[model samples]
Target: MEAATRMSGYRRHFSDADNEFEEENEAEEEYLDDPGNSSTSIDHVSSGAVINSITSKSSQSKKQSSIQQNSNQTLIKEALLRGQKLATNSREHARLTKSVTYWLAKDSQPEYAIEKPGFKRMLKAFAPRYELPGRNYFSRTAIPTLFSETYDKLKRTFSSTEVSFFSATTDLWTSCAKDPFLSYTVHYITPEWQLRSACLCTHYIVEDHTGENLKESLLEILDEWGLDAEKQVAITTDSGSNIKLACRLLRWTRLSCFGHNLDLAISKGLRDYSIEEVLQVCRQVIAKFSQSWKKTRDLAKSQAENDLPAHKLKTDCTTRWGSTYDMIARISEQQRSICVVLATD
Candidate 1:
């Protein structure tokens, strides 16, 4: 009977557990049947999915934008490099070359100056990528072309109708190499009333500079320039016998240069004994200072001490009275300093 009672107790325990489980299941079913609870669960799931999709798309878009920006920057850099390279080949190169040619011609620099290392370095500092041509190119091509263009332009201006009449001046001089050269220059008034002047020619005279030879040379120069003898108003020249005779031979109006007359008068006046001796002493002093560096340095120190201008002593040229005047003027200006320096010596 004890064994049968135990078995019945076990069955009762199981029956109570089953009742609890059934109660839990019924509660869950009631909660699910509510419309508000069901909609809230579905909305929460849909919102989570939408937020994830938007975040993923935004990440992809940012990555694409970064890549596109990098590509655009690369294209710009490449384009800039191409533009710089193109500058060396096109109008910019030509302009730079022309400017260089003009500078060289104006300054009378040798053609090989362009090939110098220092010049190349300086130019490279200004334009790194530009290629410089050889000196031969300038000598053969650029210089000749510039000369031709300038000549043609001048010729056109001189031959224009606006230039009705012109006066000329002629001079003869021997170069340092003992070669005789005769130069002719013309002056005119433009239509705008502006004074204009141009050097027509400087001819090397192999023959003697006689009156007849000079006249022939002048005529040839005028013919070459298309200048009519009738249009010439006058020719001015120094009072040299040969040149004066040449003016008479041409049979055109001739005028003596006032500057030449003034120079002659000054030269004659300076020949007085007292003035000549003083000029000789001044010249000797200048020569001494020029020959000795120590004297020059002493002169500079004396000039500073006396609060005088630091001007060098000028040597006069015998042919030009203006140079004599300049020499005398400079000596007078530095007289105290010179005395101090000589006293110290």
Candidate 2:
């Protein structure tokens, strides 16, 4: 009921795509405070015969008290559950969203939950406020609780061996999602020899990607994460000048991303040769295949009839600018196909 009214109010007042978001939020609160319902709930005082009124009033009081107690308990339970979910989800969202949405519009007017920018700001509110929950909705499980939960899970997960200081790596990138300005990641090599790269932090210093900006960003990350560059024996990177500058800023010995370099070398060599011209043809061919649903089905049918191999592009979502080895791994995994594309007459 509240949501329905809120939506109606939003439709009435929501001004423009960019401008009306915050205004819609004001309507939500108004809708939730339904004026008719407030009066209806308060007006019925039950004026009747003396005995009838006394008994009816007593029964009503008892019923209301019981309802209130149950409501309070329900509120408590819901709050705690929401808080627990918030803690877990907040961390997960931070890591995931940092890649795409880095900067937030602060101090802006609030909008309805459904409004895009309003929804974004609401989520960002959870970004900095994951400390502890003391409200009636959920039990308090802030940083201490979160860390304890993590440590326990880790201890049991690696019961066979003792864990030590983890080897770490960091990287910076502008996500194609383009929502976030900058993303910084840190990798932790565990005792079991598995590599895990998690977002340490993401910053929105500004729009331009420059050498000075890269150096400052890198320094900020290390400082915020309390990492000592001297202890980080080696860092890795692709051929990006900004990334190289970042490594230099950190004073870590740079490990060239060999796998990436090789792939890039192939790409560059192809561009310098006739490969660039051929790629335009390949792109047109792909468009022919993808132009319409009918075209896609027809292409599939023709390929099946002609016994031509279905081509697939290789993807390496995990490959980082510093991951030379990862670049090589990806290239080698599909070397035959890539070679055919590159060396085609």
Candidate 3:
């Protein structure tokens, strides 16, 4: 390719002045022997060749530049048309809309596409004619439709006869809003012998927590997904009396969640007086920065000045295993920056 490029340049030189090819070669030889004398000598040999070379290069450059401009303009027009197509609400556009909703859901970005003006502007810049759906459209229509489709797909996927047995895991927890919810997940082995897991459902359980109610909910979910009740392996949950009673009522094998048990063990170990004091100190230190925007900004500034990663402090959750380890590790990594910030404050 390099040799070809050199040959192409040579061709451009010769195409300009056919008479100067011989004189140009002679000038090259003189230039190699005595570079000082060759500049004056070459000017006499073929000034026309030099002039022709410059004219050909400039003309080629202009043509290339013009071609690039036209190509860019064509691309811009095509992209604009594509953006318009996305807005037209055709099947393709619906698919894109569905995909965007899925992205938002997967990333826990509830209304980024709808409520974020910068995001909307980016879409508009690409296609000015297309209109973006409002947040209400996503909340009221798009998300529900997507959920139904995904549920259907999950049902179909798990209904395969190749899956002989499935183990279920259920957790009932209260959200920040103090709403009680039950989450169900299923684990199974494919015919290929690969283990897989999927969240089956999460829904409000407004009724009082009872064994019979839990059993009924579990059976309904299994029947909806076409899972065989007889082929149930085990139901895993925290060692709660209600969950145990539910499993016994359904006649499903019961297994205490290993993760929950481990967390309990770790929590007990961390209850040592020395560990408690240290954790208390760590929490207060992180709380000072994390609870206020100004302190967080100052910490970030300190990190930047100290040539350290601007990682924020993580507050550990009491019920979550390994969270303390993570929080402590981050604090250790950012210790110098934390010191700098403290010193300044």
C-alpha local distance difference test of each model: 0.90, 0.54, 0.83
Error of 3 at 209 (Å): 1.9
RMSD of every prediction: 16.7, 28.9, 13.5
Which runs of model 2 end up more than 4 angstroms from their true locations? 1-168, 187-197, 304-345
Tens digit of lDDT per residue, candidate 1, span 241-284? 98888889989899999998999999989999999999999999
Please give the ranking of all candidate structures by lDDT, highest first, separated by commas: 1, 3, 2
Model 3 regions lying over 4 Å from their true place: 1-89, 126-141, 288-309, 334-345
Q: What is the lDDT of residue 175 in candidate 3?
A: 90
Q: Mind sharing the TM-score for model 1? A: 0.75
lDDT string for model 3 (1-345, tens) is 999999999998877777687789987787768968767876765888988989999999999999999999999998777665454557756766787688778887867456687887776776465566778888889888988988888788877676778888899998989999889998888988999899988878988889888888888888777888888877889988888899999888888989988888888899999999999999999998877888788889888888889788998997667999898999998998888778877
